[model samples]
Target chain A: MRKIGKQEIEDMAVGAALLGTGGGGDPYIGKLMALQAIEEYGEVTLLEVDEVPDDALVVPSSMMGAPTVMLEKAPSGEEAISAFKQLEEYLGKKIFGTFPIEAGGVNSMLPFALAARLGLPVIDVDGMGRAFPELQMVTFYLDGISATPAIIADEKGNTALLSTIDNVWTERIARAATIQMGGSVMNAMYSMNGKNLKDSGITNILKLEEEIGKSIRLAKENNVNPIEKVLKTVGGFELFKGKVSDINRKTETGFARGVATFEGLYENKGETLQLRFQNEHLIAQTENRLLCVTPDLIAVLDAETGLPITTEGIRYGARCVVIGIPCHPKWRTEKGIATVGPKYFGYEVDYVPVEDLAKKGVTL
Target chain B: MRKIGKQEIEDMAVGAALLGTGGGGDPYIGKLMALQAIEEYGEVTLLEVDEVPDDALVVPSSMMGAPTVMLEKAPSGEEAISAFKQLEEYLGKKIFGTFPIEAGGVNSMLPFALAARLGLPVIDVDGMGRAFPELQMVTFYLDGISATPAIIADEKGNTALLSTIDNVWTERIARAATIQMGGSVMNAMYSMNGKNLKDSGITNILKLEEEIGKSIRLAKENNVNPIEKVLKTVGGFELFKGKVSDINRKTETGFARGVATFEGLYENKGETLQLRFQNEHLIAQTENRLLCVTPDLIAVLDAETGLPITTEGIRYGARCVVIGIPCHPKWRTEKGIATVGPKYFGYEVDYVPVEDLAKKGVTL
Candidate 1:
């Protein structure tokens, strides 16, 4: 186990934002929350998945709701603790450790904030190697892990401990509740033992996020293009470099649902790319080619700073590079594809690996 | 304590439906559920609020959703038991008894159905002497009793145990969840000790309902006008005797909302009356006069049989008698009026007691 200090949190937030693929909340807000918690409670211990005993219970710390709502009303930290406490009380077991449910700006950093305050270790593994919009889009769900007895607590001191028949039901009910509870709520769900985590979870996600963040930071000092360094670190293929043209977004049914259009720049002029999202980027396509789809990672990096821009942060004139990376092998399975693939998101497209799509150059 | 058999269940269902003020669920369905449970599990014990120990835990059994939805998707009985079991587990105490949260056909009978299955006593009391649409429109809320830690369970075996800052939040969150959980779910909420029930609840509500039911049934045998007998039994006034001219209703936002128009017959032949409702009837008025408004009870009964007709049961050209009864004295208080008054239901009128309105004849 290694201790995670402020520097680790800062780097992790940048990396997590990239992997978040334009969802999982804003990195600036997430970074501030983690930095503040670490400042007050000191460094938190980061434990590898194997460090936890097989029988010890572990829960992921995260939030559910439209990221737009979370921007205006950040969690007060108490909601996360309240959720954990309620889950423990209901399960009749003390949580051994906490971890990120997904790699997002807020989700990835939240574990550290909670662990620092509670004096618990932050597990290195995450259910998703990259972020997905819905709660059931996790490898744990693919492996049949139940997301209930899950607790969701609002900043207003309201909480609901849900026990659902399946993880999908958990997402449906919890999403509805999250809307009513001021459009955002902290969640302590997907509680499981270490064996399930080691077997199903994407291990060393935090390490990868830190490395991605470091690569971007070092590229600036070395006077090189940060986007190239970021793409190399994440093993991602550059889809398009473009300037934002037209973006339309609206918060509806507890989701930031909209599409962003980009005018191709530099190497790929005279082309238009469309990125559609429901909380996270679900599809990225150019005029005659399917660049990437869900179960694949699609991130937008600032043309200058190489910092990841969330869906909410994409502006009318911003210049950016879009990239796609292959998802974890778990998400490539038939069950995972059925659970979160393009068809599940209403895209009518068949499942194709990002690597395959990248190699083929263009497939409509 | 007394034993509640199938006969009592039948009578109470009729009475409870009337008290539901055209909102609570259909009596036929509620009666069938209670009678079937009684048939299998034997008689349920009925206890006066005073009979319960001061510190013993008691939760009310009810359902929250549009009655229209409950009609299409009847609960499987397992949902109610699941809700109670979850609540008991969360509280870490055996529930000493169960009661109705409101005086509605389904709300009143659900307690008996649950009590029979669990062999628990049914408390002879309820939060609302008459039904209101929203969860917080109960005396328990006025008296500062919270509705959480509450449990809501669906027929598909999903449950959510909610804890909120107040009853209103509980309603908001649970209502949203109920919509997602197939539009209806059984609820175990407003848990309190015996003392609190005695202090805040409307006592002898079941006894009153049974007496009203018996009066209606006896009227047929006595060859009497059942409306007169029913009015005398409940200390209610005849607001209008009319044939239904028009009726409109649609279930929206988890509530059956509509307006029923009546063309007066006999002594009131020249006048037309409009009754508006959200779950329960909230207002009854003529163009020239206000007859009754919530929290006073407004019930529509068959003019010939004196059996109550729910808002959903009202049909064009059906002859009916609209009656108004004074609410419990507790609901006349300032807080009670604010909680379930005419103004609360969006009617721009002051609350006048049904007795006063009847004595004055017409005040527009």
Candidate 2:
């Protein structure tokens, strides 16, 4: 377990932004918040899941709202603490640790702030191990953990506790509350004991995220293709390189959702790629076939700057590269396909591994 | 409570169709499923909450999916039963009765099938008295019952048992599974013991639904305005009477989410109303002020036919009447608004009582 310095966080901010693949929201604000917390409480220990005691009670917490809104309505430091403190009081147990929800912009950094404030280690793992739009779209769901008794705290010091019958309702009701509270609020949810956490969480995901982030930073500094470094670090497959020609977007149910139509810029020039997104890319469709599907990580990065572009940030005429990384092996099984594949996103395409798609383009 | 027969079932179906507010899909299918189950088994007894044994283990079950899909792909009756049976096994206890998750549309009738097949009585109550998009967006969620141990059964006889840490995860993961299986799947979730049921269930909601359904039927047959009858039955307030001039819809995050813009047709001509919806109506806004906000049920119905228009069914040139019913008084409290109100849905407007809105000429 490494004790990261303030300098590492700066590097992480850059790398996290690349891994965001255009939609984790700006990491700058969350980075600042986390840095301040670390300064106030000292360095946070990043614990691997194995290092966690079998009997320890760890809760995964973060902010749940519009990232676009997060940019406009910055979170007060109090909210993160309030959300965590409320859960601690409700459980009548000390929180042993915390962890990032994903390896993205703000979400990746938000947990570190909580851990620093609470003087607890941040777990090196997340449920999805990647970003998803809704609170319920996590491996934890597949593993049988509930997101209820979620604590949501707004900037005004008003705190709300939600214990739903299911995670979807937690998102639904909490979403409404977030909107009511001005589109963004800090939430600490997915409370569970260590036994369930060990059973459900993706082990060492933080280390993986940090590595993914670090590789991109190193690649950028070396003037090499960050995409290649990402692929090497995560075993991701380079799907296509293109220039974004047309971008269409709309906010649906508070999700910044839309599509980006890209014209191939490299050897694949004149070939168009269409990527659909709802917070995160779900599908990458070419004229001939579907290249990447859900559950697998689909990201689009600026060809020149290597900056990740979010759905809301997509605009006309941005050169980009599309990459696909294989999800956890468990997500490839029948259960995984049923939960987060192309068909799950309303596409009629079958699940195609990123490696296969890289070697042989998907058609039909 | 009145014992529902085949004849009453038909009337209830029609009433539910009108109450569905252009969503909830077609009630005919749920009616058919329930009728078939009752026929294969026997008549289902509807017992008031008070009549249920204190020790009776009542499970509130509903099928969570897109209503449009439910109409296309009829459910195999086995899923609910399988879920109930599985939950029974997990609990190591026999379930005494069943109840509907909601008392409107297909959800309202599904419990009958489970009760008849299980030889258990159906309770005269539900979580939401009307329809909602996600399973977890229920009153039960506010009351603190988990939707876990949820059994999701597909038409292919593939049953996935999910035990999530929260309800949101339950909905998210299950929804992914349902979409992968096809567009829709059957779910028997929020299985609660009678003690929990008594504590969490909305007492007498089934009876209220029946009464609401029957009143609409009687009003229609008597050539009276069914909307008025509905309002009188539930003390609802008229929010707006308008013609749907534009319906903008697109699918996002696996949900048919969009906005329907209405132009007032009668006394309020020249005024415009926009109702934003994901699965259920989340916000109602006019040019001047917020007409109605969530947590207060906002339903749209055909002005002439008195039939409800679903969010998906809303189209250009449709004459519609928007109604705002007071959600259960429990929802009007501070906690309730925090859980289900306009603020809950991300509206800047403060929650105005439905009755107050009616008196304020749609500007409240």
Candidate 3:
């Protein structure tokens, strides 16, 4: 796993920001916060999920709310760690480690900040390995875990404990709270013992993020398409390259939900692709056929810069490239599909690997 | 605390269905499944939150999904217990008791079914004490608990664990999977030790639900407005009595989000009110003024029958009474307001207690 230093964090943020596309929220504030943390606490140590002891207490830290609000509002950086400590006390156990919830935007660095301050190791893995809109969307959820007794702490040292019936209620309540807290709140959730992690957790997602980030940096240095490099690293497929022709967006329930239509480029010329986003891309379609849906990663990037464009950043006339990556193999199982497939997103589309879709010459 | 029998389950479901206000989804399937489990397992024992040891492991059981689909596709009944067992093994600890995530419909009885079979006591307290749409919208959340390592078990014996960055992701991933699992999945989440329960949980919510249910029954028999009785029990303020004039809804991200407009009656005549819902009534507004929002309890009932209305069941022409109950005083604190008030739900309005709103001389 890559051991990220203060220097690497800036590069990683640049890369993470690129992957965030426009909607993962601004990585600048989070980047600054994490860098400050690293400077104060020294470089963060990254460990694989399995490296955790059977009894280790692992917690994830993140910022919740609209990306737009985060840009305008600076975080106090005390909430996540405070929430973590509160939960640790609630469980009557000491926390051993911390980790990111995803590999996108501000969240990608939240764990880093917590781990640094707590003097604990941060896992290279993330629950999602990517970003998703809701609280329950993670590989950990697929592993049958709860995100309860979650501590949501605002910048003002005010903290609340949310124990819900399910993960979604936590989201519903937390989302509202985050908005009220001025569109952002640092949260510590999904606390689990190491025994549970050994069986259910995905290992080394932070390493993956670093790898993806470094590869993009390398691609830029070599003057190559960072998209191609990412696809190769993740074994993803190039779905389509195009210029954004139309964009539609609206903030619902404090989240950016919208659609983008792409006018195909290069070999994909004359074909059109429509993509939908809710924090992260939910679906990609070419005319009548739905191409890739949730569980699988549908990412849109600037053709020139190879930076990811989030729904919040999507604008008319932006030239972009749409790429589809295969989700974790586990997500392809019948159980996995039921948990995160396009059908889960209200699309009637059946599950199909992005690579297979590419091989079929069905452009999306 | 009430030791509920199968008969009480039915009445609770009926009452919960009303409180759901056309949105909690039909609790019919969840009810039937819980009934079958209870019949097979026998009667469940009840325990107050304070009765347990501080270290006791308490797990919550419920169904997560679109309530609309719940009516069409029923649960298999095997999942809740299965999920509970999986969590137990993962934690390497036996659960001391079971509890409902909320005290409405099937979720109210889910813990009882499991409790009977597992030979454990069912906690009389629930997270919300009422029904809410998302997984994390619970008093426990306000108390600073996390809902990670949540076990989501499908009917087909497939169970997944999710530990998200936050409760919101937990909901997003779990809901997506629930939809893929054919619309409904039995979930046991927000497992916590008793110490956390006492610190912030809404203790005795199940008992309160039972009392409310029984009081409603007694009130009906006594020719009293059961709605008024409920209001008195919770010390809530009557907001308005009206007939639903318009309902606007759309299914987005698998949730039914919409608004219902009401034409006031009696002293509220000529004044109009609108109730917003997303699995639960989130806000009530009268043009420029806001009446109530989450963390506080908003219940809609049949004016004539004094029955609650589910979020999905809101319909035009239905005569209803909208009542606003103050949430636990804890929710009104700055921390609490940051966690559950209207501002959290994306409104710019300040939080005003239902009692205070009533004292303002607003017509109801």
What is the number of backbone collisions in each predicted candidate, taken in the order shown?
1, 35, 94
The superposed Cα distance between candidate 1 and the true structure at residue A109, in angstroms, equals 1.0
DockQ of each: 0.94, 0.03, 0.04
Index of the highest-lDDT prediction: 1
Ranking by TM-score: 1, 3, 2
Query: What fraction of native interface contacts does model 1 preserve?
Result: 0.96
TM-score of each: 0.96, 0.53, 0.54
Writing each residue's lDDT as its tens digit, candidate 2 over B259-329 gives 89999877768889999876678778789867777666788888887666777677789898998876776
Q: Write the per-residue lDDT of candidate 3 for residues A26-73, one digit (tens) a residue.
A: 677788888889989888888876677888888888888765666666
The TM-score obtained by model 1 is 0.96
- Which 10 residues in a row give candidate 2 chain A its minimum summed lDDT? A156-165
Task: List model 2 lDDT by residue over A1-364, tens digit each.
Answer: 7786577677677656655655667777878988998898899888777788887878776777777677777786778887787677767788898887666667888887777877788887777767766777777777768776676767765555554556766666666556655667787788777777778777776666667667777777898977777778778777788887898888876666788899887687878899988777888988996788878888777777656666666678877888888877767878768877777667777888877887787676
lDDT of each: 0.89, 0.74, 0.73
Scored against the true structure, residue B357 in model 2 reaches a CA lDDT of 70
Per residue, candidate 3 scores C-alpha lDDT tens digits across B281-354 of 77887865567777677888889877777766678899989988776676678866776567776776666777
